[model samples]
Structures are given as structure tokens and as C-alpha cells.
Target: MNDHIAPPTAAPAPALQPVRAAGIATMTALALAGLGWAARGVWQIRLAMAGEPASGPPDQGGGVHRPLTSLEDSYHLVTTVSGFAAAVCAIAFLVWTGRVRDNARELSGTRPRYSGLWVYFGWVVPVVNLWFPRGIIADAYRASAPGERLPRSLNVWWGLWLIGMLSGVGLMYGDNTDEIIARAYAHVWQLLASDAAVVGAAVAGIFVVRAVTAVQERHLDEP
Candidate 1:
């Protein structure tokens, strides 16, 4: 009778964190940032064609630099604001990823391949940054929904992110407007390419987030 106290039932799944809200937040930020970059790309090309100042106009005889044209001023303002927003977007994304990761562990009752800290540092550290971010997400997906094949959007997003970061397309940002415009002189094509890659990655990332969130939601509902 003592041995019959319910012959060892399976362990219950750990408590799951809500994933949809985080997923939605991440997707929205990504979409906005992506659109901003796309607009900036077009604006930059137009500015380049319109003869942006290479040396801030002819220096006044009094040694004062001429004021920036309205167009140039606008570009600087837009880029500065956009750059700041990108930083914010990064934080939001990490938060969402962490949320999903935590829930994944709960749902599967297995340890993630990477430690929790990797969710942030893994994206910035050299070498490991190349694969860690993708791997972390993939591992979470697998753990939360075992046996299902990974989604195609995951690979697409990762690929575009790598291309944008590694191909010198990242030279588009700088501390000053002059520097920003100057860097585009010989690498306009690369800058545009990077923008396109980032935009595409953002779109793919939305899908990946959706898929992961959806599966985890479904898994959490299982009896």
C-alpha cells in the first residue's frame, strides 16, 4: 500500500513566463527601427547626389566654418535620433529573448546550452558573437518545442545580421555629420547594402519571434 502512492508520475512542467507580450514588443521595435533605417538609406543616397559638403563649405575669411545647409542639418538630426533609437531597440530585444529563454527552460525542464548572461554579452563579444546569439535562440526554440524543425526565418535573420555587421556596411555611423557623409564617399554601395540587409533581417526576425512565441504558448498549454 505504501508503494502504491501514485507510482511516480512525470514531473510537472515548470511555470512559464508570458511570451506574447515580449514578442510583440520586440517585433514592433524591430519594425520601427527597420523602417527608420530604410528611410535613412534613401535620404543618404539623395543627399550624396545633391552634393553634401565634404569640408563644411568654404571656410569664412574670419576662420569660421559656414553653417550646414538645411538638408545636411536634417540628415544629422535624423541619423542621431535613429542611432539612439537603435540602442533602445537592442535593449528591448534582449529583454524579450531573455523572457522566451526563461520560459523555454521552464517548459522543457532542461538547461539552456548557454548561460543566462550570454543573452546580452553573446551579441557583443567578438568571435562568439558570430554564432552565440543565433544558437541561443535556436536552442530555446528546440527546448520549448522538441522534434519540430526550426523555422526558415531564423536562418534568414541570422544571415542578414551577419552580413550587415561584417561587411563594412557598419561604417555608416559616426560622431559627426561630416564624418558620416565622408565615410559614404567610396562605400555608398556597401552602406546601402547594409541597410537592405538590416531591413530584411528585421522582417525575418519578426517571423522568428512569432514562431517561437507561438510554439512556446502551445507547449505551455499541454496537459
Candidate 2:
């Protein structure tokens, strides 16, 4: 009888996912969403310039508030539309990240540092949100591009995104439109700075997506 035991067979590695088309789609979605946010910022500046005035006294015991002016009403509409676009764009970005990550696995022959679920959750999960998304992208970059210097565009993008997210922009953020306009009235420079950072983040993010995707797409042609 044979005394030696045979070793267990390892599972087959996953096939690489195509990323070129996903990259194009993500870039287009992000561009539209970013432009929408910029437009909202412009409207906010217009509102600030016009002295975002309150309609009337605080609604004590359910008194009717005055209706919105055309400009203020218009700002509200821009905010709503931009917000919806942002939500859709976020989904597209996450999907692109997932594809690149799987391609990284095939290229590097190693598992990603973060799990697949983190691709979606990392952007929203409190402290983890701060780093996981960057880590995921960077790991893929290192694997796909190998010797290339990790570009500063990635760092710039993440930094601006953090600044925009933590202390600025978004209706879901604590400061409502009226309150933000009120604050902007008191501190116009602050509003300008916040909007600039948000828009800058969006622009830098485009370069980042393009750089990473281009490198990975090229790698697909390698022997």
C-alpha cells in the first residue's frame, strides 16, 4: 500500500475582468456629476451675491413661511438634480473599482488587501472610509503598472475629496441650504473655498481614473 498522502489541489484562479469599457463609462458619469456639482456651486454663489434673504420670521406654532424667490427656488432645484446625479455617479465609480480590483488579482496572482465588499462600503463606513478606497486603488496600481512611480494625482484627488466630504458640500451633510446660505452671507470666502475644493476634487479624480485605467488597459496587451 502507498504510505504517502497526496496534497490537496488548489482552486483555479479567477479570470481577469475587462476594464476598458467600464473605465470609459465611469469617466463619462463622473464628468457629468462633477459638472453638475460645479453648477450647483455657481448657483450658491449667485444666491450669496443676491443676499439669500429669509422669507419671514421663524415658523413659531406652525405659521406659514413665505414662498421661495425664483433664484432661491432655482438653487433648490439645482441642488436636487446635482444630488441625484451624484448618487448615480457613485454607483458607477464603485462598479469600475470592482472590475479593476479583479483584474489586479489576475495580474498579480495575489488577493487584494481589502475584501470585495469594501469596494462599495469603504466610501461610507466611517473611519474605514478614510483609507480603504485609496488603498484599493493604490494596490491595483502597483500590481498593474509595476515600476511606475505612484502618481501625485491620486494623492491630490483623495485629499481634496476628503476636504470636500468631511467639512463641506451635500444636502445630506448637516448644514441645510438656508443655513449654508446664511453662513455664506457671514463668510463668503469660506463658501468659495469649500466649493473650490469640491470642484477641484472632482477634476483631480478624473485624471486619477484615467491614469489608472490607462495603465491597466495597456497591461492587458502584455505577454
Candidate 3:
């Protein structure tokens, strides 16, 4: 008479909820708009350097350079507004990134390589930021891919983002120069570089966000 009992079936892993990326999408749009504003500032500066009158409303008497004056005011306004928008975008991005990290951990059914908290700190901590965020993102992509090969979007986005951040730091240092003429010249080039990098990073970032979200959602739909 056999008295051995059948082993109970193991419970299935919890389903991974789809990650909401609306915040990320908004951040990407803001980044692109900021880049456009930066480009406009660069163009205005270039016009001044070329000794050409900025294109705008015509002067209405009193010999005042109304177009140039308007351009100057608009430049300052755009720069200020873009900077504020960028800060908001950064915060939104951080929140969305944390959500993605959580979803990746759930999909893989394994502990994340980095603690979830690192997702926020990793971007702000000086030297550690250079590679820490990249590592976390790579891990997320792999976890979401599971048996599939990870796409190149993650690496491209990371590289562009790092370059943009480094260029922005360089621009900050360049701004501290005491030579007004030299500083102005340096700023034109620096702004151009920074803006270009920002555009590239934003475009690449959109692809990475979409790819990761899709992969994780696919995993959740599977039996």
C-alpha cells in the first residue's frame, strides 16, 4: 500500500503589469522642444556675430534697433523657459525610469543587479553616474528580452546621453571665463554642440523607452 502523496503544484509567477510611459513620452517631447529653443538662441547669437540685423518686427522710428532688441529679449525668454522645462523633464524621466526598473525585475523573476533606489541616484552621483546608469539600463533590457537578443537602442541612447551630459558640463565651465568676447565665441560653439547632442539623445531615448515597454508587455501576455 503506497502512502506517498503527490506534490502540490507550484504557484505561477505574478503577472507583470504594463509600464506606463506617458511621462517618458512627455519628457522626450520637452527635450526636443528645448533643443529647438537652444537652436534659436544659437541662430540669434550667430546673427549678432555676423553684424546682421536679427529678423523680426521693423524699427518704428527713434532710430532704435527694434528687431535686435526683440531678438535679445526673445533669446533670454526662450533660454529661461527651456531650462525650466528641461528640469521638469529630468524629474519626469526619473520617475518613469524607476517604474521601468521595477517592471523589468518583475518580468525576470530575479533580483535586479542594482537596487531600485539606484535608478534615481545613479544619474546624479558624480563619477558613479558615468557608468552606473548605463549598467542598470543594460540589465533592464536583458531582463526584458529574456531569451532574445537585446537591441542596440539601449547602447545608442546611453552613449548619446552621456555625450550630451559631458558637453553640457563643458559649456558650464566655459561660461566661467572672464574674457567677454572669448566667452561669447565659446558659447556659440558650445551651444551648438549641446543642442545637437540633446536632439540625438532625445530621439534615441524614445526608441529605447518604446522597445523596453513593448518587450515587457509581451512577456506579461505570454502564458
Candidate 4:
């Protein structure tokens, strides 16, 4: 009776994609860098508004100001670099989101509420963009954690992101004047608000990414 051998046990499921983890890491780094640049810009703007030189020549008479130097130049450079970094981050995030969604579907044996393409388009379309991406992320989080209450990090990140985006758009409008005096004060408050929101969003996003990745990885390891 003891001569029978037991059948081989099945192999454990593979872990989450490494590329997805890499993408999240890269995005987090870029987001942090972007936040630093935005903070620098805000600081420079504040210095300029306080009637300070801001690492450049002081304002002269005749209504003609000297060309922007030091802080202004560095701010512009940071802005350009951050803009490119943000674009890269967006692409990475899309790819990472797709992988996460795929993993979620595989783990749950069901299709997500939104199609995979929504991961990219959800953040671009007008109006729906406001909540679609959040919903997608929420679905992923729910799938990973089952019946656990949704994480607050997602909500905080989304709220700050929305505020930053709206304030950034507002910067493009309003009464921007060529006059040195008017230009100096124009949208200063909005710029500060945008920068603050960006910083908040980036910080909150890091937590969300970490939490979701951890949950997914744990789910993948389940028997």
C-alpha cells in the first residue's frame, strides 16, 4: 500500500514583470526631479517678486529690464529638462499600467472595467480624464487587495494631480502683459499653487505606486 508515489506538485506562479517595476522606479525618480525643478522655479519667482535681484542684475530705470540671468536661466533649463522627463515618465507609466492591468486580470480571472488602451487614453480625453485614470488604478488596487478598503494615497495623488493640471492650464490664459512690472506679478499665485500641487502629487504618487506594486507582487506569490 505504501509503494504508490505522490504526483509532482505544480510550480508557483511567476512574479510580476521586472520591467513594470523598473518603469515605476524610473517614473518615481523623474517625478521627484520634476518636483525639485518646480520648487526651484517657485523659489525664483518668489525672489523676483520680493524686489530682489534673484541671482541677476537689479532692475534699472527706463522700463527696460536686463536679460534674465542665473536664476531665470537655470529655471528655464530645469523647466525644459523636466518637461522632457515628464514625457518619458508618462510613457513609462502607461506601459507599467498595462502590465499591472494584465497581471490583475490574470490573477482575478476576469477583465477589468476599462480596456487596456484606457490606461493611455484615459489621461488625455477631456472631462473623463479627471476620474478615468483614478478609476483604473482603483480597480487594479482592488483586484490586488480583494475586499480591503481602497488606499488613501490614490485619492490624494489624483486630487493633487488634478489641481496641478488645472492650475497649469490656467497659467496659459489670463492677463499676461509684456511690461516688466505686470509680468513680474502676473500669475505668481497660480504658479505657486501649481508648483505646490505638483510637489504634493509626486510625493503621494510614490506611495501609491509602492503600495500597488507590493500588493500585486504578493498576489502573484499566492498559492
Provide the TM-score for each candidate, comma-separated. Answer: 0.87, 0.85, 0.74, 0.75
Better of 3 and 4 by lDDT: 4
Flag regions of model 2 displaced more than 4 Å. Answer: 1-14, 54-64, 169-172
Cα lDDT of model 3 by residue, 69-164, tens digit: 444455546656666667766776666677777878876788998997788889889998988887886788788776776668778877877877
lDDT of 2 at 85: 79
* Cα misplacement distance, residue 134 of candidate 3 (Å): 1.6
> Residue 128's C-alpha lDDT in candidate 4?
87
Residue-wise lDDT of candidate 4 within 1-223, one digit each (tens)?
A: 7669788898656445644465466567747556764754565475456553543333444665677655555555655666566677676667777777777777667889999878989998999899999888788888778998888999998999999888767352342222222334444665666767877887787777777777887765655
Q: Which ten residues in a row have the lowest lDDT in candidate 1?
A: 168-177
Model 3 reaches what TM-score against the true structure? 0.74
Q: Write the per-residue lDDT of candidate 2 for residues 114-199, one digit (tens) a residue.
A: 99999999988999999999999999889888998877889998998888777674433776665555565566666666666777
Best by TM-score: 1
Error of 1 at 80 (Å): 2.1
Q: Model 1 off-target regions past 4 Å? A: 1-10, 53-66, 173-176
lDDT of model 2 at residue 194? 69
TM-score of 1: 0.87
All models, RMSD in angstroms: 3.2, 5.0, 6.4, 5.7
Instruction: Give the TM-score comparing model 4 with the true structure, all chains together.
Output: 0.75
CA lDDT of 200 in candidate 1?
Answer: 89
Q: Rank the candidates by lDDT, best first.
A: 1, 2, 4, 3
Q: Candidate 2 versus the native: TM-score?
A: 0.85
lDDT measured at residue 198 in model 3 versus the true structure, 0 to 100: 71
* Candidate 3 clash figure, as a count: 0
